[model samples]
Target: MAYPIVITPEKNNEHYQYLVFLPDFGAYCQANSIIEALRVAVKFIRDYALINELPPMKLKLPHSTGEQLVTFVNVNLAAKKGK
Candidate 1:
């Protein structure tokens, strides 16, 4: 499944460059780049799905600023299980 994720650039933080939010799961992760953010988000969703029931995909996304980006990360749970 392809899950929606919101990536917002962090200005003050020195450790990370972006804040990634998984609205459906009400979870968040940090990364230094957009590519890394998506990677972390995908791993998080896969791990969360392994332990908990997946929530219904939200059609509406949370509010974001002009610099924030919204994108999708595709994950295949069935394939993950085989690993």
Candidate 2:
């Protein structure tokens, strides 16, 4: 399933470069780059699904500023179940 993620540039934060938000799960993660952010977001969603009932997918995305980007990250929970 593909879930919408909002990526925002973190200002003056030395530890990470971007903040990735998963609206459906009300969870967020940080990474040093956009690619890494997406990777982390996938892991987060997978782990969340493993422990809890999956949240309903949202058709509408959260509002983002001009500097922020909104995109979808695909995760295959069925494939993860075998691990």
Candidate 3:
């Protein structure tokens, strides 16, 4: 199953970080880039799915706040240690 992940850039932090929110899991993952964040988010959801049922996601993506991004997390990916 695929999950919707919203990427929002962190501005208040000293170093730039991307915040990944998985709406279906009601979870978060942080990384330096969107791809990396989504990758992490995918792993998160997979782990969560193994434990509990996932929530139904919205058919439409979230509206961008001009500084944020909307993306889907594909759960099929195998994790690489350094990715």
Candidate 4:
């Protein structure tokens, strides 16, 4: 099953950075930087879903309004490493 995933980056005080992930079923994760953040985020989602016996997520990025929200659809997890 393919599920949508949204990524949003926010900077607090120009020092602290956080990325928010809005996956399917309201599954969300936050971290710093796209690379490190996603690494942990994916693991978190996987573990969380497995714990709940949920299906695999396809990973999608839906468009969102408001500032600090970076949305992308069908983004390859590997591609995030470069950013």
Q: Which candidate's TM-score is highest? A: 2
User: What would the per-residue lDDT of candidate 1 be over residues 1-83, giving only the tens digit for each residue?
Assistant: 87789999999999999999998888999999999999999999999987899887756656777999998888888888895
| lDDT tens per residue, model 4, 1-83 | 33445555565536436656655656666666766655555565555555585555545556676655554323343443454
lDDT of 3 by residue, 21-75 (tens): 8776667788887778877887787777666877776656766787888877666
TM value for model 3 = 0.77
Q: TM-score for candidate 1, please give it.
A: 0.89
lDDT of 2 by residue, 7-83 (tens): 99999999999999998988889999999999999999898887888878876777888899999999998888775
Candidate 4, poorest ten consecutive residues by summed lDDT: 71-80
Provide C-alpha RMSD values for all models, in order.
1.6, 1.4, 4.3, 6.5
Off by over 4 Å in 3: 77-83
Show the colliding residue pairs in model 2. none
Rank ordering of all candidates by TM-score, starting from the highest: 2, 1, 3, 4
The Cα local distance difference test for each model comes to 0.90, 0.90, 0.74, 0.54
TM-score of each: 0.89, 0.90, 0.77, 0.53
Clashing pairs in 4: 3-58, 5-60, 61-72
Which pairs clash in the backbone of model 1?
none
